[model samples]
Target: MTYIGRFAPSPSGPLHFGSLIAAFGSYFQAKSQQGQWLVRIEDLDPPREMPGASSLILNTLESYGLHWDGSVIYQSQRHQRYQEQIDSWLASGLAYYCQCTRKQIKQGGGFYLGTCRHKSQLTPEGCSVRLHVKQAIEQFTDQKHGVITIPHQLAQEDFIIKRRDGLFAYNLAVVLDDIDQGVTEVVRGADLIEPTGRQINLYRYLNQPEVSYIHLPLALDEHGNKLSKQNHAPAVDTHCAKETLIKVMLFLGFTLPDDFQSASIEQMIEWGCQHWSLQQLPNSLASSTL
Candidate 1:
């Protein structure tokens, strides 16, 4: 099958080191396989988005020579499409309106107990939409992490597709967007492994083919915390693009020549693509200090 990959990021902040690692890894992986690599701006949550973050992210990627295929899709512009999918799910009894708050769910033992599954008359204003998960994706094989399994109870929970704040949940939006973009492989950070099972089930519910997954190691700080925008990780220096690219390539387990360190960005990237090894990537990056 023709391989297609994507790097989807939320517009909550500018591109940081962790973000670059994900983008660079995905770009190299796709280029190595001669696959199409696309970029998607996950701007569904308006309240969390920073002003100009979307443009800044695109600019950063370009500065690092990570040009994406086709036009970059913005989740904000696809509200109608998401609504259409939700309506279809509701009509088919695959999903239902949920009125249970976080506190109420926690009080009932954390996982949702289907309290609102039978409540068809619940108003949609303050309600969220949840998938009525009848089947479970027990296990899936990851490209890097090998076999992964989901617990029966966790798999059976009626996960929310839309939030009470009128925003489409990440689980729902990502699955739909992947299908829409024909993403054949999802290469992202290992932090998202938990959601893999949920997304796999979503594909089955929507009658869409499942995509392959490869989760890269996450860059962490000295305290062992993942480098993230929420953790206030500094944005990557686009002015030092070549140096940054070399560092990311090394992080992905590529050994470079001494003279190549002084090579141009394009040459380094070409060498990286030619020598990219999926087996060399460590399960997790110990720290970002390296």
Candidate 2:
């Protein structure tokens, strides 16, 4: 099968170094195999989205020479589709609405106690659908790291797929999109490692094909915090796209000379594909962001 991969970035803020790493890593993974690479704008949360951030992300990717194949898929435009999947889940009893508030769950600790699981008159008002946990262990391999298993206790927590305020949660939308896009493999930051099992459960619940996954170490500030918009991470310079690409290459465990440092993004991509190998990347690192 032809390889298909993507970089799904939220439009809450500008693309930072952390965002760039994920884009570049997924880009190289696909380009290395001469596969199709796609871009996805994860704009499901309307309130959190910055007004013009999506356009800026596309522009930045263009500047960085991380061109995507086909028109970019926007999550905001797929609300009806998300609703359809949710409705199906509800009808099939694979998912159900829970009316518990955050404070209620917090008093009992982080996990929801499934209080609403058996409530009869299930109403949508101020409620969200939580997936019924069934797995004892959610295990999968990291293409880079060896055998991995997220414990059942962590995986058993009832998780929300839709919000009480009526927005489809990231976990649900991402699973649907990944399956719909026919993603063959996923290479993203380690921050998302926890969500892997939840997404895998959804994929199985929906009976969709399983896609491979790889979670790279996160990029962090010197303070040991992951760089993010919340941390006020600076937006990357897409103007000197090649310079950023070179930096991303070095971060991903590639070696380059001063001469190649001056190369354009297209040239860098050519070189990257030629040299791409899992063995070249760092097996472990404190932090990673392009």
Candidate 3:
């Protein structure tokens, strides 16, 4: 099978260094294998999305020479696809409605007690849809991180697939789209490692082929917090694209040749693809300033 990979980013804010590193890692992983690379705008949450952020992200990727293989996919326009999966899950005995609030779950030791799993009468007014996780996905091997195991207690909880506000949950939408796009590998940051088991279970629940995963080390600030839009991480300077790419490469633990330091964006990417290997990547977060 042909290799396929993606860099799916939420439009909560502009593309920051953390996001750039993720895009860079995924891009190299796909291109190095002569595979198709796709970009997905995860614009499912309207309230968190900033106007024009999606366009800016696409432009930034292009400016940095991380071109996608086909038309960029917008999750907002694919509501029908997400809805169909949810409807199917509800019809089958795979998923059910959840009416428990955050406070209720917290009171029950912070994990869902599956309170509504047996309730037949559920009103859509304030109910969310949750996947009934019957089996525990204790462990799965990551291409880079090696044997990653979810705690048994956390693996058996019925997690939400759709929010009460009618927005498709990240875990649900991502799995469905990965299946729809025929993505063979998922390469992103280590911050999303915890969600991998849930997504894997969803793949099994839907009876689809589970994609391979490789999570790059996270870029953290001096304080040890991961750089994120929620923490107000500044957007990357695409005008200095080459310099930015160098930072990402160094963070990923590559020693560039002195001659290649002055290479253009396209040259850098080509060189990166030729020289990059997942085994060389560091497993721990490296501190850096924007």
Candidate 4:
């Protein structure tokens, strides 16, 4: 089977150094294997999305020479596909309508207590949808992290597939999109490691082959917090694309010659793919400074 990888970013803000780390990691991984590297705009949450952020993201990738394999996909345009899966699950008793509120779940010890699993007959109005979770998957092997075990409570919980506010949940959308795209592997930041088991469970629930995973270390700030849009991490300067790419490569544990500072973006990227090694990557945060 042809290796296929992707970088799916939410349209919450413009690209930052942390974002570049993930993009470059996935790009080099796919290119190294002579595989297809795809890009997808995860615009599922409208309230958090910044206007024009998607276009800005694509332009930045092009500016930095991280060109993807084909036309970019936008999750906002795939509602029908997401809805079809949800409808099928509901009809087959694999998922059900949920009326429990966030506060109620919190009061019930944070993990969902399956309070609504038997409430399939409940009205859909003002209710979220949750997977019945008959088979709880608590562990999976990561290409980089090896065997990872999830807490039993979390694994057994009947997680939501659609929010009460009429938005699709991230786990459901991501898994379904990967299946639809024929993705063979998922390569992203380690910050998302916690969701691996849940996504794997969804894959099994759908009876689709599970994709391999490789989560790159996160990019943290001086205070040790992961750099993120929520923390107002500044957008990376595309004018310094070459410099930034070199810096990112170094953070990923690459050892380049001093002359590399003058290398063009294309040259740097070609060299990166040729020398890509997962063993050199740090298992913890990449760095506190870019």
Q: On residues 7-97, what C-alpha lDDT tens digit does candidate 4 reach at each position?
A: 9999999998899999999999999999999999999999999999999999999999998998899999999999999999999999899
lDDT per residue as tens, model 3, 241-270: 888889999887789998877788899999
Candidate 3: which pairs clash? none
In candidate 4, stretches whose alpha carbon ends up further than 4 angstroms from where it belongs are 284-290
Off by over 4 Å in 2: 285-290
Clashes of each: 0, 2, 0, 0
What TM-score does structure 1 among the candidates reach? Answer: 0.96
Report the lDDT tens digits of candidate 1 across residue range 133-160. Answer: 7877778898887897777778778899
Evaluate residue 281 in candidate 3 and report its C-alpha lDDT on the 0 to 100 scale: 88
User: Which scores better on TM-score, 1 or 4?
Assistant: 4
Candidate 1's C-alpha runs over 4 A off are 284-290
User: Cα lDDT for residue 156, model 4?
Assistant: 87
Per-residue CA lDDT of model 2 for 1-290, tens digit only, reads 99999999999999998889889889889989889999999999888888999999999888877789988999989999889988887887877999999999888876787788777588999899888877633687788886677866677777898999998999989988988898899989888888888888888888788888877768888787898888889999867777777778888888887699667678888888888887877787446533
Task: Name the 10 consecutive residues with the lowest summed lDDT in model 4.
Answer: 281-290
Q: How accurate is candidate 1 locally (lDDT)?
A: 0.88
lDDT of each: 0.88, 0.85, 0.89, 0.90
- Candidate 1 has its poorest 10 consecutive residues by lDDT at 281-290
